[model samples]
Target: MKELRADIERAGLDTLSGRKAPRARVLLIAGRPGSGRSALAGELVRQVADRYPDGVLRARLSEPDGTRVPVGRAARELLDALEAPAPAGAAEDELGEALRTALADRRVLLLLDDAADAEQVDALLPDNPDCLAVVVSAGPLTGIADVRPCTLGGLDTKSAVEVLSRFTGSVRVTVDPRAAERLAEQCQGQPAALVLAGGWLAARPKAAVADLAGQLNADLGQGTVVGRVLRLVHASLPASAARTLRLLSLAPAGLVDPHTAAALAGCSVESARATLDDFVAHGLLHPVGGSSSPQYEVPCCLHPLLSALARDHERPAELQLARARMLERTVRLLQSCRAITETDSLRAREKLLEMPRSLRFPGPRAAADWLRVRRPALLASARLAVADGELDTLARRLMSQLVRAMVAHFGTRAAASDLYDVHGLVLDVAERRNLPRERAAALLNLGDLDARTGRTADALGRYRTALDAGREANDPYATGRAMESVGGAHLELGDYDRAADWFGRALTERLARGEGEDAARLYGRIGAAHTYAGRYGEALRNWRAAVAGHRRNGDVAAQARALSELARVQEYAGRLDESLRTCQEAVEWAGRAEDTRLQAALHLRLADSFQHLGDPASAALHRGTAERMLAEEALEEDSEPEHGANACEIRSSSAEE
Candidate 1:
């Protein structure tokens, strides 16, 4: 790339090197679809990245279908790259501000690729003068000030021939220099066209450059040099390989793997893989990275041609069926990805056995790695399926599996932002299909994510809607869950009275359904709301009920925690003796529960109570015991051997009755 794109690369580097501007240095790399703008931008970053010192942040500003990526989503992605927190459900302006703030003090390089317009680029530009931004688009950014676009065109004749040599050996090029030059000229010095022509020659060792050049000269079709060359090369493929190439266009984001290709083409994985590699040899696809799974990317320049071919040769129903197969395959893979993590579930293990070996993950780590790498494509698949509109059932299943896979691998909190989007998609499907149960579930999930991200008001609205939907669907679990969530949101908003009211309503639902444990938890929530409202008498009653319920359930840990809360409220209500007795009982329960930390905390509370009562000797003894317990706990933690410096493990478990 450095040799072929020498002039543009040098100019871009020079523009980036000059940091004397008042704001971030902006260099726009504008070109046609296959002019290699992305490749050049990457090379420039590779050369000048160290000079920035902070880091280089890259984002694609458009979807593969030419739709503009929302400014908020783009900002959130950049913020994620910076390892900065982006609040879920945040407005575009707020996220933009957060992004600018994150880049303010850092000397970072921003590579905004495939930008749709000047506004998209402007919104994400860092305010810091020390930063630099390279914007890649198909045309000049008209609104950005003092910025000159480094416009790209086809490669030079010499460079075009060199590109050909890389695919076809130099010996072939050296043998027929004139014919190579003629072929390069016929390609209009376009790198993509040259590569395709070279791949054609490389595939047939007996065919000379003159043979291809003569063929192109005689067969002048009604298109650009690239289009004509592509048609010729595509026409030369075996029937199976040609169909595989056409189906590759259906791949989300133009990213294809053997499994996806096989599903799309109705072939075996090995056959799909061979066809993909063969496409790579023909310059129709580019291998992504040197991964064992072998993913390929359809070049941006050729995507339209392939899609056109598919439309011409494939029936609409056939295309839809192929898409359905791909999505179904994706859903199963996601199911296996998540099920692999449930190592303790015999049902999950049995499900894993039922799946084909190609679909199953080796272990949790490999499953997580696959999920992380395939996340973008997976997300794109959901969006595409939803937009198709006719496949709502498949869309729902895909989103459900995607959400579960993400949560199983990345945790709820870490994946909240993405889950928020998936839940919205679910809501879209549910509303369109008019399915009350699914609508309620989607709303509940969205509300939960909103609450986790501190959007209390938004969460409150979603919860209320979910409650209505749940009741309409006669779903007791969803209704009860929604009521509880509403109470929690009210608590977060400091409306303690309303929170308590909602908790009571939810408690009634739980009790009526004979859900004892959930009813007990609701008692604790009601107590908390009452305590916050300074209703100590009511708080005491509720806390006592919670403690009794936990005792009945034989949950010593819960009982101890409940007793501690009851003691606090008792002390608040001036029943010092009762508080002291409650604290002692809590200590006993904690000990029985084998909760050393809770026991230590209870002992400290006992010490405080004794000190307030003027029993100096008892207070001192309790304090000493508490200190010894904590010290012993710390020693136990220190005695454990350390793993490797970077070694960390995340274990997730489900609760058992």
Candidate 2:
């Protein structure tokens, strides 16, 4: 930090007490790879922390290979950092605008580390001058205007020696000053190289610095000095640990925990964890903080080197086997997670118990927590699995399990947006494998997500394609679901007549399959569609048939649902007396079914009917009853049961498609 004091002061940034100057509030810290640009950025952050009291926001703008991360993803990360709500399915321009607005009037220090080019950084720059951005890249960001550039070279010898001392201890460096100088010189005075050299020496306390210096000069004569040092460090590890190090390059987020490492190395969890700890001890991996379990990440600069080593030294079969193990482990874990979430399914409970204890979660909450923590890695694995064509079977099952797990943890509607990318991957796999059923399922799921996220046109298109696929597969379940989903989408779009037509077709499939209970449910859905279209007579007929079917099936809850819909249609048709009778019957069935919410809703319907009939005293009585029932149930309006399935309702726009 002291080495950059002159550059910091020369930037002419305003103090906290002063108004920021009307200039492009960006600073460029340009340097070559391995020149410690990121380290300098961190030091700058510490130095300027007090000046920017609002917050310090940091985002990685590029991969280690200098490939730019998508601007939209970067924008989303920034919005998350700011704690701003990003609208679902929003475009890049909208997200950029939100980010600019979030930065306005705030004193933030935005650190965009390892930026690839000018366009990448320009889009994320804050419009507010009060905010400051420090972009660290390999060269000056040419297109961005009004920027101050601070080019970084190799750390001077003194700073470089200080870097080594920090890792290996001052006593060690001082005891062999010449050897230490020789090592620093070998590193070309680069902080990154020095840190690796220092870490290697720090790990072997008894090894002389001079001997190690001679080994570096003799062997590892190719590649950058840092790359060769990494290879030396890697080669020094035990075979098991070395294999673990190479396999970790496959980790999706460049981060791994004990369980993931164990899966990759085909070792016991304890052994993999110990290997990870040893790697961290030797500075081969860096510890990433804020995890329940200890987590370590391979440094980005070492990725290509490690990957190359793995390819050269490890068999393709071995690597593929390792990846298969990871996918299988992930699939099992997700299956267990989904099992626990099926609170009402006795069979699911039995299956959960049958799973290996290691795969099983203690409870649903534990499963949910794991899902939240491992979402990124899990998604990344799914993507890679799909891309690896030979793993299509595993990928398909993995994606199916993920969707189920997410639905269980986050509910269908809430999980849809977050799992959108996974659904797309599922579609890709389905197309590649020519699995019509899977393709239909993926499209239907995506459509449901689009519907919930307000992409009406997209939802309709997905539903239509899903319907075609379902028909081609000759899958009744998929076809029925797709038909109903199309109706749901039309209902969302206010195309009530079309919704009724689709719902009627779906009902025909359910009835043909002799799924009496499901048919009853679909009848109610068809009734809703008719009601929405103001075809009260058609609604009444379908609801009456639904009521009869539920009665035959001995489903009191379904009977109550049908009768409630019957009452609604009667009221809409101005048959007040009939509606009152139907509502009373619905209330009786609701009480029998112990559905307090349904009872409250029926009472509310009775109240409305009485009020419309000009009977204020009766209306008040029913209204009071409705309020008391709702209070007893503690029910919120439109609140569905957290457990148990319900008849599909073709509700208004607010319904989940």
Candidate 3:
């Protein structure tokens, strides 16, 4: 005990004697909930907080029972403790500004414990950066942009043992060090749990350490809630606060702000804020964000129990309503992020007309930024909405919107893998619920992603699995799609024979399904494979078949590609004039496809044809146009960088949604 205290004090001296505060002075004591944050706070206050003697005040931003606490009420409580009489009905901003004024020159150590987010921390920051403030929260209080953050994690084995030994005698720990350490590990290194167990052991002098460990292990095995004491405190809250706590159990993000919470609970923001304050007073919540809106979080110590209880008691109707409202908002935000994709297009006015007032985005960039900011919460919401146990069709729609929005606004990497995971989860639930189409759709979507990212082997496996599953389920469309993906993967791996075989199989399936467009695509793949294998005769035959099929189906894009291949074969066959004429027709078809890459390729090929025939003027004109178009394409791609701006826009937009 003596050695540990001495070491802590030495470290405290190191903390206290450091340089003066920066432009933003925030001491964030970050750790997971119930890791002895309060005890550590008190120790730091006693030892080193004296540097600021103006007025050292303590505030509990989160309740011990795992609920959100509000900032206005927290500020009022701080003011009351500081002996500063606040006017009745002071708004949060007024109270926050007042608190700032009170601590401006005082150099007080404001110990805001269990803070939920940066919003609450920002509200209480001293006007004078010289004033030191220790803001403790479960996670990083990052919303406050430039503040210095000191994150704290779990205690080490030695410190945890020493702290517990303070209650259980040192002789007991020394005599059974291994048992003592194992006990600490079983407690998950949570200081509060260790302290409680150690105190109970201290009262029972005859209790063996091994016996206690066995007892705890037994309780865990039996699901008797051995690590659930933190939830009992939550269950003891008043009815209003308890309901608020349960509603927050559905919070997509780990933290919740007042307005969104109000929306979820079908109450006013003031009511939600007041409920948060009441819970904080009762030690049931923690205040999270303060930079923008007030937010709160349930401590991790209380999370497991609270989650289990929620699973048992949450109201289905309320949850569904909240999920639907959140999705509508997400759809609006997604449209905003894809604003550029619709500019000057037919859908521009239609999209604008469909947008909701709540969809106010500063710009397309801001909309994109929101997605990046709220990616985790968006993902969680999708998962939770699917598990609503009702609204299966809406779940499908939500998943589709999620996929479209992710691919459009942030590209494949945004949620492609996560979407695949969620789709799998959804597929399982849907199959159990007897929705075969939903299962097939999810499987086929995931299989598509698996193939696109060069996961040829994995894609092949997924395609085969989905094919068997869909066939068993009598879903011909999915079976056909799966065969196509399997063939695509083989093509990517340069397995010409296997690729052609799979493509033929897919063509048969699509033809049976009467899917002409898809069958044409399969024929084009067969032609391309033959070309890659240098079998010009077989390639020419396949290309003619593909061109005939695509023209019959009026698929200009496919026809263009087939015509280009046929022209190349003719060029190789020494029929220069006929090849040049066919190349011109391919260029015309390429323009009809409206595909920039194909258009560029056709232009380059046409230029080569002209150059081969010694037509310098024609060749020069084509080359210049291609070069100019390529430069413009490169500049456009570089204009919006893939990193900071684009990613931030997506994140920020999602937050708004």
| Top candidate (lDDT) | 1
User: Total backbone clashes of model 1?
Assistant: 0
Best by TM-score: 1
Cand. 1 Cα-lDDT: 0.86
| lDDT for model 3 | 0.66
Candidate 3 residue runs with Cα over 4 Å from true position: 1-33, 37-238, 258-260, 268-295, 304-370, 381-398, 509-514, 552-558, 572-577, 591-597, 610-621, 632-657
| Predicted candidate 1 versus true structure: per-residue lDDT over 121-233, tens digit per residue | 99999888678888899998998876778888988889999999998889989999999999999998877888899899999998998999998998887877888898889
| lDDT (tens digit, per residue) of candidate 3 on 273-380 | 888775554444677542333557655465555566666667666666765665655555555656644557777657765765445455556656666555555665
lDDT (C-alpha, whole model) for all candidates: 0.86, 0.80, 0.66
Worst 10 residues of 1 by lDDT: 648-657
Report lDDT (Cα) of residue 74, candidate 2.
Answer: 84
Worst 10 residues of 3 by lDDT: 645-654
How far does residue 92 in candidate 2 sit from its true spot (Å)?
3.6
Worst 10 residues of 2 by lDDT: 648-657
TM-score of each: 0.92, 0.89, 0.56
Instruction: Show pairs that collide, candidate 2.
Output: none
lDDT of 3 at 212: 62
